[model samples]
Target: MSGGPGPGRWLTDRLSTLLVVRMALERTGAPRTAVAGALRWMSPAGWAAAAAGLPATVAGRHLGWAELVVAGAALLAVLAAALVFTVGRQPYGVDLRLSSARVVVGERAVGAVVVRNTAARPVLPARVELPVGTAEVAFPLPGLPRGGEHEEVFAIPTARRAVIPVGPVRSVRGDPLGLVRRAVSWTQVHELYVHPRTVGLASGAAGLLHDLEGRPSSDITASDLSFHALREYIAGDDRRHVHWRSSARTGTLMVRQFEETRRSQVVVALSRHEADYGDPAELELAVSAAASLGLESFLEEKDLTALTTHEVLPAVSRGALLDALTRLETAGGPRGFVAMARAVSRDLPHASLVVLVCGSGVPVRDLRAAGAVLPAGLRAVAVRAHVQDEGVASVGGLTVVTVAELDRLPRLLRRAVR
Candidate 1:
């Protein structure tokens, strides 16, 4: 009286079978989707032919129709022939190597793909496809005998700063009718970082001070090297810091107080909001300017923290900083300079100098608000990227400078700091 299996039970059984098949495939050095992807090898035309011809052939035989059967048989035969094109085994060993993984914008990125035949027999001519960023490139690979190889060298033009994905070399086989198609990936994807072009800035530019002993602040501490004053010793005060001579003179326990000294740290925050810039090129200029500042700070042996709209970038080394910058993109939302400044103030409260890099579209009011959020006694400077000659001005205690090119950054920064 029970049905063969309930719908839920049938689905569960099918899922269990799929999981077992996936595990088996994975254990054999094949991906779990190998079978599923194989099923999708049929092109749209092949699917359409199968969908119509199979039904037509079955119904034609049942209804005793000669023309329908003939048409269906011909369609099925075409599909079968197309399937033969994808039946052969592909014995390919692919190696994708790049000349360099990092380069400045407008430089050429070179790479080569080498394909070798691993099987004892010869490999038929085929097409190799490589996906670079959003585009796919194809190279014709000639037939190769056993132990034979072929190499294809390519160059990628880097017109703008970005992190471009290079490839996963894949071999594609398809029938001329576009009925059946098969692709097998042979190499993993690689990243090419087109870094922003940064100009050389003089050491200690932007008034960045380098001091191993640290700069003195207004905050008073009981255990620092910079002496500030002496106060009556509290019960919890360290006895080592107590001035015994002064205590004897005043007939009371006196402890020495010192001004807190912090190592010079520069925080460079580049705005990544799309609306903050008048044009796309402005943002690029701003990025280059920020990179210059960060590099200069590193060269001068100072602590540096680089930031953008949403996240903090690694500033441990110049290469790491530039790599992070290459991957940066503008935010679609309203997040801008003000948000980055607030982050610097909150997360990097001890920063001595805060450089806000943005485009000319940012309003003066926003710059003032950004400077206002920073901690007191911190030097705040804003660089507004533009397409015209550079200029400098002061707005609401914030030093605002407009830079049109990378070479003008140093002069603009010098003027702002002075």
Candidate 2:
């Protein structure tokens, strides 16, 4: 029993082995760093002296001066390396905030990142990286005392309509003299919506409503808002709508005839293919035009569906329309814009009005073909956004409007068929 290993000794041995193993792994992972730091701390000259004095120390000469120095240096390096790798927390945490979730192109939006050092102990300075779309911004953070905080403001670019990914701030820490480095992510990613710039216009310009009452139908109904003509009152005719003066003058029971008023639907089909707009400006204008029409449709509280090259977005609310517009990219897949437009138009034959916004690069013949595919009695309008200014015209049974600039979208949209 006396010769056997004690429980305390066994536990100490296990802990020591684990510590050694962990240190070894860290050193191996940072070989260049460890070597560089060791060189700076203990020079080649010092190493040579340590090696030279090793045999003398073994012989019990001069009380092992060089050996003691080398051991102390090695222990210092191990402790430093361990500390460098294990401090994973930053003094401050970051909260990302944007002034507005939705903004128009060419408009400025401000964002603030609130960094707070809520730790109980003073923390070392660190570096933070914030991702903005394709760009990365680096911030050199200053060391903060306990419970200290700072706020930083940044500008978000709205040159184009898009949903930009903003954050997931990352903190980086490292030794001063090429020793060790570590990185940790602090926040979640956020999206900033940049909506297309548009102009205010009447819903009638989009052909959604022919008149105040609505689109008229050939089918006659017993009772309706739109007046058609006066006729002799039948047995089932409601007396409330009887034309009393006309009945007295004619000595007969007469009732006002009315046509059926149908609620109109406006569908905006926009070409999202890059090929459709060879010029970037044209594409931007096209987006602006579509956005304007969609806005009008929403403002008027009419049934509206915004269509891209291949997808359909129902503009149920202003937020939903803007969200879809923000996320719509230039490329719309392989089916191509013309074909997709025709297919969509054909499927929505019942729609009262359909508006197509495309880049200038699209051919007039193709636009005509797209219009021809629409269901009978459905009206269609085409808007071509381009750099070369052109007047409005009608080709192949569809009215085409030309928009040279985004600012003139309202004026040009007024010329559209009602």
| CA error at residue 150 for candidate 1, angstroms | 0.8
> Could you give candidate 2's per-residue lDDT for residues 1-418 as a string of tens digits?
3587889999999999999999898878788786665454433444454455454445443475676656655645554664454355555677988898778888889888777888999878877778999998778777788888877788988888888999888777765543445566778898988988877776336343534237778778868888899989889888999999999999999998889887777888888887788687888788778888888877776778888876887587888887887777788455365676676666775677778888877887887787677776667778898888766888787788887876776666566653
By summed lDDT, which 10 consecutive residues of candidate 2 come out lowest? 203-212
lDDT of each: 0.87, 0.75
- Superposed Cα deviation of residue 221, candidate 1 (Å): 8.4
Best by lDDT: 1
- For model 1, name the residue pairs that clash: none
Q: TM-scores across all candidates? A: 0.79, 0.70
Clashes of 2: 0
- Score residue 259 of candidate 2 by CA lDDT: 90
